[model samples]
Structures are given as structure tokens and as C-alpha cells.
Target: MTDNISAYKFDWPPITVEGYKKAENKVIMVFNLDVRTPAKVDHVIQYVVGRTVWCSLNSPVNVNILLSFDFRGQGIIVTKTQSLKSELLRLLNKANINNQVSIDFLI
Candidate 1:
């Protein structure tokens, strides 16, 4: 095993992913409407919880979350290269959930 130790030395981006699927029957929703450092950190947990809920809705199939900051309220954007983009768009429209959803934090 010592011979393979060097394999772990490669430089990797700090990017990390945390969440799971099918933890609950209902889908949850949360997000950071803003990209600022302070705001992003402030709401990350709930936002991710919401994301997990969203992803888990498609259980039995593996799903990933792709989040980014948008200057415009463009809602969630799945990778363009993925075939699921169109399907997700239809789902959002059918639900009548607008591009911008509000986030409320309670003390």
C-alpha cells in the first residue's frame, strides 16, 4: 500500500459536496439569492438542505447539485450538457415556481 501513497498527493480544488438522497418524503427548497461572501455563508446550510430535498425527489436515480451565483433571478440552472436540463425546466414551469424564491432566516 505504501507504493500507492503518492497517488493522493495530486493538487485538488477546495470544492466539496455534502448531502444525501431520499431522507424524507417531501422535497425541501432553499438557496442563496445573493453571491456575497457573508450572505452565502449565512445561508449555506439551509440552502443545501433545500437542495438535498430537491435532488431526492428523483430517487432511484443518482443526482447532483450544481449551484452558482446569478446576477439575474434565473432560478436553478442544471448543466447545459446534461439531457435532464429540459425535463427540470418543464418541472419548474409546471410547479409555477418563479425564478426567484425568497429565503427567510429565523433567530
Candidate 2:
């Protein structure tokens, strides 16, 4: 005798709960600094991480820092709401070294 088994994948909460589903609206923002010196890279990373932490603490929305590293002078931030992303972008753009930094959004 032989037996067959099958499995299926299920997504909890389903798509119907769109308003309460924060994950569906998650946004990824990538930043690249033009600085080549190690000190400059460190400074940029520090400033970004600091601002991100501050925002996360003070804001009601959720903020997830995907990655923050000096490698190639790049950083990535993920936020649950678009407003939070805009706030961070504005803060970063207002910095003195804004000219040396490039920001882009993925999805």
C-alpha cells in the first residue's frame, strides 16, 4: 500500500484586513553617501542611526532599521508608514552634508 501527502501554505490575517495590516504598507529606503574617507562614512552612519532611533522613540509609527553599515557607505531603513519615511528623508536632507548623500526608495 502507498500513501500520498500534500501541504499548503497559508497567509494569516488574509488580505481583507488591509487597514490593520501594517506589513503590507512597509517601505524600504536606501541611502548612499559620496564620502570615501572612513571618518566621513562613520559620521554619516552615526547621524542616520541617531535620527532613526530618535524617530522610533518619539513617533507612534513603527520604524525598522534593516541595515546600517559603512560598507560602500550605504544604509537602509524600513518604516511601517509613509509618513515616517518622509519625516526621516526630510531630516536627512536638511543636514549640512545633504549634497554628498543620495536617497532612493524601493517599493
- Per-candidate clashes come to 0, 0
TM-score of each: 0.25, 0.33
The lDDT for every candidate, in the order shown, is 0.35, 0.35
lDDT of 1 by residue, 33-106 (tens): 55334344335433433343344444334343333333244333334213222333343444444333222221
Q: Top model by lDDT, which number?
A: 2
Worst 10 residues of 2 by lDDT: 1-10
Model number with the top TM-score: 2
Model 2 Cα lDDT, one tens digit per residue, 50-100: 544333333334433332222342343344224334544555444322222
Model 1 / residue 50 / CA error / Å: 2.3
